[model samples]
Target: MLQNNSELKSKIDQLWNKFWSGGISNPLTAIEQITYLLFMKRLDELDQKRKADAEWTGENYTSKFEGQWIPPEYRNQSEPEKFAIDKRTLRWSEFKRMQAEEMLQHVQGKVFPFLKDLNGAESNFTHHMKNAVFIIPKAALLVEAVKTIDDIFAVMEKDSQEKGQAFQDIQGDVYEFLLSEIATAGKNGQFRTPRHIIKLMADLVQPQLGHRIADPACGTGGFLLGAYQYIITELAKKAGAKDLAPDEDGFIRTSVAASLTEKAQAILQQSLYGYDIDATMVRLGLMNLMMHGIDEPNIDYQDTLSKSYSEESAYDVVLANPPFTGSIDKGDINEALQLSTTKTELLFVENIYRLLKKGGTACVIVPQGVLFSSGKAFKDLRQILVERCDLKAIITLPSGVFKPYAGVSTAILLFTKVWGAKDKITKPATENVWFYEMVADGYSLDDKRNKQQGYGDLQDIINQYHARDAATDTDRTAKYFMVPRSEIADEKNNFDLSLSRYKTDVFEEVHYDAPDVILDRLIQAEVGNLDEAELAKLQSGIVRDLLDLKGMLG
Candidate 1:
């Protein structure tokens, strides 16, 4: 989405390069340091705005930067202790003006510790920040990074004013851009899902306010954030907002904070729950949500596949693109997941199902192999979806969708938890399953993934999916159609859910001439006796023409 502003993108690129040259070359490290700086700036600005707003509304306000501060470590010392520093000095605006060396020392020693304790001891973000290091080594590099961040924010403000895009939206985009710098996949095939794909899933699932939404393997909380944004945009729409615009992916969106009421904000903050095994990812996910105005994000460092995770049937919605590879130790896998295999991909599907309350919906991404693998475990997994739940849709994604990190073909599984035989003894829960084969996702499938002009099949998938009717959407030749449960559960198919199993391929008939006649025409062309139109036809169908010619020659 930041691609719309070349200047902002260039500035962020320069900021990243500055970090690379400044001895913090690791992307995760660089992003963490950048986040700290952005947090500093945002903290100061938000506090200032709130103070002013309180004044205008004649309400009491307590600024986080108010009052004198003493280092907690030195607070119990005897009299004459000189450890007190101005609380205001921690502000980005104040320290940015200091000489580079002094600025670095103040930030490293005081500001960072203050930030670590900003939310008090009980905060998850503060707990994660306990071990965080501010490693901008050189004074000149730190100064340049801070200056560049200021310029980036300046550009964002200008763009907001000129384009009517909310400043909060631009801020979220900036953080997303920074997160995108982490290019490599983590252990267990963990990689950031494309944001547009997340948006598409959020649209199909339609996560509403007050819904307990979750992502079990949330790397940087993209799905949770997407749901949050989707909810906010819907609220903005209901609030009579007319400035809403379609994003680069064609989904209408606005700022996360725009028109957000305080009561609604608190509920939204508590609605999102995420878990990840990687400590760094957990921290990043927490900050990712916090930076988007989700105070008290529920992301934590816990492997949901492990036995320790037991929050089954708890959430109203689950949106996830879990790790596509890696298997958990059989002994360590959560007993709640009853999938017959140790395959993480298969088990995660079961885990997501368990995570949902009865009748709750989930939109998950899984490897295409899960759809039609010959293994009995795979068949059982599909059967669980088809028999135990209402398997609504299977949207196959292009292989290149995860380019530069992975090339594995994937698909989105949209389903709802249901009581199959227990409630309906005569038949299964799912009556029909919809299928859509996505050809493109609005970007080039190469490493760069530059945005294309149109959102190929993305918009259509959303519209056609919501509007699909079992009786009307039966044309298998179209891009999207529905298949009856009996057909999907046929013995020969073995519960295969792959789109190719049911989709009808239309073939065109081609008329061919007799071999002798085709050879005579080619021979005439060889002798330079044929007209331009005859030569063009022969060239256009060279394979067929040459096959006929070779047979006649033989």
Candidate 2:
């Protein structure tokens, strides 16, 4: 379906309303309380399906699938029919009376053995849920909320693959919920990276449908999801007939929207890859991928900052918006990605640069000031890039790009591997660089950022980037300028990635009164009031008297 901004926003709001209607408002809290519900629902649904399948073959299926011992509890009150339902209310009071710790220990011992590898589950959630604090102000409200979500999931589960408008609607809602959680994460630089930024970077690189993409700093996996979207849309176009409308985008079966579970599953391992240090964020990122229809996500909770990968792991493309502040703890930074600089952003920049192959491309976000800061640390890094890599573009975004959000004046730097551009028989290989001042990335990002308004208008940018010629002296100060490899290679190699360093702003004029106008105003204000006239006369007399004396000239 065609979607305008208004349409997308409306759909997102629709999903939020659906969530409230289904009652899972506290996403942070719901997972802990809803685990028991999910377990019961799965138990009932799985056992019944197994029994049906087995009876068709005249075999005993109940004992084989549900477990060695069906929990005595399952026999009392059956699975809640929906993801929105609370598992606590039962016709089974005795089961509810089982102590929280004791029940989980017993369940973990006997029940979990059968339900291995459920989607969106982490082993930790199961291990901790029994003893996890379920401290919502009102336990009953929590119960009601869980029941509502139960109903919602039940409807969703009618078809295993998520697809169509409802799938889009539901997943869009989930995206915002995930963003909200990150927003509240606050100051830790766990703040949300605007999706448009990801989309814009995607446009800049236009990753081929089959290429691999990774975000080593994958916060909430925003970059990974963007890469997934790019691939999915492109893949659909490839599979579709030349003149016909698009084919089933992952096979739709519902009035609601969802990801094609199998399509997403296949893509998860092959296409999208990410890692983050924050365990909380890793969970949310996985859920974000799953809720958006990705099954068996590739996201992991390990700190990418502390790990290294082989040359085989080099990606065809890498996109990252590394956190702006904080230094990597001394002994913890991953050797592959770590830089000589203790500052985390600088370390990540060098890390991302190193991770790409001889010709791999990267689009990374950085603080505007990093481009020209004459520090000893960044200077050499800049030198390495200019001397070795093909440094292509710099985009300076406005200070308010983060507005009402967080104000971090930033820029995007583009680079590609040099391959044998170095050690070639020809002249120095990496030469011209393009610089563009996004002024705005086509969006307000203002609690209201718009794509059309800022650099979000990417078609022109992409075109200019391709048509861009070799570095030149004159174009260096133009709005969208070019700098020669020689200019960049100069002794300083300022590699200051800031766009403003190269692109000249169109300095606008302001009206100014002429000098006569200023003099007339001064005379009108100070001229012959009796006191002013007398003072002027006294001053004139003193000058005349002084001038008449030889001593005055001497």
Candidate 3:
């Protein structure tokens, strides 16, 4: 979402070069230095406005936190505009009046709290302020470091094209880097969702205004962000307004601005909830929400599985690409969400069920193997979902969805918690699983693609999904087919959610050589007719395959 943020980039790079050259000994020191620069910029922008307005003490608290504090000798300045990185010795001499911890305590309790009290603002800066270290007294390079960063953000503009942050776009690399830096124990396989796929999935789920959305695993909050964009996009389109880019704020029409402002206000007050096991993810989630201009996100740092969530059918929409963790420690899940079983996806499925309100909808990304992974666990899950919720659709995504890095053959599994299902629609439960197979799903399993070529061409599959009624098992041209509920029941309640089971093979037209042409070939050079026994065997095989198709259609 960055645009014209070149200042941020150049300044950040400059700061990095300076810090690396100085040979800062600790990783914490690097993060602290960068954070300190961000803190100061934020502080100056906020306080200057208050001071100009004479809002503090009725007498203007004119710029106490700005670059004015650094001594000129320690400052990095030009002839006109001046700023400085306070020298190490000078910083110690001036700041030695307090201990390192006390400096941090003062910043948190006094300086940071002043910014926290601004009107029309609600921030937990005080909370995260605990992690905002002021180790200048010990890591004295830290004070000298703030100037290099001031130079960085001062010059480089942030790139808007990069998906998550202005820094990286290698798909999930944002979450990957964050996990390495902040939360290495980011629960097995809990990486971020791919961006394009997130957008596609959100479009299909179609969460609307006033609907509550939740992602229990909530890795770096990709789904929540996607859903937010989706809803906002639809709302904007409905209001006949442009989907203004973040960088295009100056182009906002009065009508669009008013609508977006109202919608933004509504969301902060009413919708959006998320939880994660990792505190670091929770912080990232909050930052993400804040960057997207959502205030007061109800994102808590808690283990949804470990906590008892009793409010069954509470949310309107649920979207998750949960960690494909295979099994869990017996003690991990709370008694409510804890099944007698251990498979992570299965537990999450049940957890989603409990979280949804009646008639609520949910879309989940799951390992394709789950569809047919034979087990008492899978069978029970299939039975519960088909019976309790209207199992609507299953999209078999290509195996390379997470490729080159993590190649997992995944599928989009969807369900709706409704008043009830038509218990006996004269079909088996196993047959009821509408399996849609995209040709893209069978593409090269190598976990990488040419970025120019794009990945997973599933628009046709999505077309068929939206064409719920027009779709059928008879039209072999389409990528999807459905079995009757009775048929699904026949799989002995094994709702594998695999597409291959439901989609009939599309037989391309084969042109056979004419009899005269064959005779001409024989006359010109060639071969004899097949013997009776061989031809009979071929005929038998054809007959058997026809019967298989016939049965698959039913």
Error of 2 at 44 (Å): 13
**Which candidate do you rate higher for TM-score, 2 or 3?**
2
Span of 10 residues, lowest total lDDT, candidate 2? 249-258
- Give the worst 10-residue stretch by lDDT in candidate 1: 419-428
Task: Summarize candidate 1's per-residue lDDT along 465-538 as a digit string, tens digits.
Answer: 99999999989999999999999898888799999999999999999997778777766666466578876776
Which regions in candidate 3 have their CA more than 4 angstroms from the true location?
1-187, 243-258, 261-264, 419-432, 439-450, 454-458, 470-473, 476-478, 491-493, 506-554
174-268, model 3: which lDDT tens digit per residue? Answer: 22232233323324766456555666677678888789999988855778877776676666667676434321211111111124655465763
Between candidates 1 and 3, which one is better according to TM-score?
1
**How much does each candidate deviate from the true structure in C-alpha RMSD?**
4.5, 10.9, 12.8
Quick one: RMSD of model 1? Answer: 4.5
Candidate 2 off by > 4 Å: 1-139, 143-166, 181-183, 241-268, 307-313, 335-338, 419-429, 445-456, 471-478, 505-511, 514-554
TM-score of 1: 0.90
TM-score of 3: 0.64
TM-score of each: 0.90, 0.65, 0.64
